[model samples]
Target: MKIKKEFPSIKVNKEDQTIDVKSESNVGKKESKGKVGSEDMQNYFEQLNEIKKRVVHLQKIVRRFLKHVHVTEFRWKSVIGINDAALTGIICGSAWAIKGSCIALLDQNLKLKIRPEIEVIPSFFHAESKTNLTCILSFRMGHAMGAAIRLLTYWRGSKRTLVNKPQPLESKS
Candidate 1:
């Protein structure tokens, strides 16, 4: 469909094939202009729409990244053999700082089992103010253990089977 546009000054000459489009000289025309074209408003809306789309895409990526981070962090903490209490403390701290909540150390079996041993150690030896050799060693071992556990777990997939308990022998008749 051919779209016909109307102009204030231009008249279409029907006699000839060539239409003479005219321009009324506003060359020295006094500006009685108040508000002009709505083009600016349309452009602003388009720009805002583009920005909204980008923001949504960025939010999606951030959500996915956070999910992976929380899962990996919780898994590593469990493997490191830190007691549930310590792990809980760490996760709580992380949650306070970051957006997503961390998984509780008590929720995992390994953290629940090992945390008692960590807690049993004397606080004087591993005081936060002073770093003793035992504390240093323990921290290093914990980090390494956590990393190793994470890799092992990843390799093993979802279900991990540890040592099988021995079956009790039946009494002879």
Candidate 2:
């Protein structure tokens, strides 16, 4: 009891404060970390997947466009009327065959329903069985022509189609 002590015990006084500051600080840090860590990772992965899907979709669209272009170009170059009358005849004949196949599968019940929309079908189909056959043949011919155009060509839209029409040659002086 006689010697005086040089060091004293440090006391943290908390009586004046309403809340514990240390606990509050720790909670804030944890919340901030949670937002930047797992949450950001989740969002990043989602965005990456979305971009991949979009790229694939765009690739398919581009491929289809290219195919259509090729078809249009081929039609312009090789088709008759659209190029030679002989080619047109062949295309119509093929379309007729396809039409026959479609009619065979569809039968009379379905044919009656579709008849109104098909105005160009031949009326001479006397046989119940032959009606669908004839209709199918007609449809096939048309479809063949479309397929030919698609396979053989590309067009620069309606303007190109208009400009390509038949024109008479003028004599020079």
Candidate 3:
């Protein structure tokens, strides 16, 4: 049986070798030909608003954490040193490897195409005496993690919506 690419709502049962089609009129009573119903559009807008609210809430939490956290001490070693170089190399290598593995797994399992671009910017705080030191390590780490979580959430949400979208009904005579 030939499946029409234009009609994505039709599903073919491979086991029984049968095609199931639903009528488009049954989807929404007010919907006109080639046009979505007002109710459906409103529902879509509502969902988008909900998503935006959730994202804003998440941002507020992150901001609160950043504002309240206090870091007591921070030490930055020279990368020219053998130990520092080794440690940096290990950390950077491990992070890239994990990202690569995750991309590979996602591609293999979900057929997702993802290209990851990572950039690290280094910032330094210098004080005259060792006693006067204020570090923002926790804040920086929290911000990074929060951003990563937000990105993952958005990706997953979009993918889920795309994959689980309701199929439109096939027109009936």
Q: Which candidate is the best by lDDT?
A: 3
Encode model 3's per-residue lDDT on 17-117: one tens digit a residue.
Answer: 54554323333333222324445456667776565554545555545544544433332222111235455555555545665675454334332222333
Q: What is the lDDT of residue 87 in candidate 3?
A: 55
lDDT of 2 by residue, 121-148 (tens): 2223221111211222112344446654
Candidate 3 TM-score, true structure as reference: 0.21
**Residue 165, model 2, lDDT:** 29
Q: Can you give the lDDT of residue 113 in candidate 1?
A: 21
Instruction: Report the candidate with higher TM-score, 2 versus 3.
Output: 3
TM-score of model number 2: 0.20
lDDT of 1 by residue, 1-173 (tens): 11222223323345543233332224353222122124434555665555344343444443333333311111221111234557645654553333222224322312222322111121222323211111111123445455445444443324333333222111111
Give the C-alpha lDDT of model 1.
Answer: 0.32
Question: Which 10-residue span in candidate 3 carries the lowest summed lDDT?
Answer: 126-135
Candidate lDDT values, in order? 0.32, 0.32, 0.41
For each candidate, what TM-score against the reference? 0.16, 0.20, 0.21
- Candidate 1, residue 30: lDDT: 24
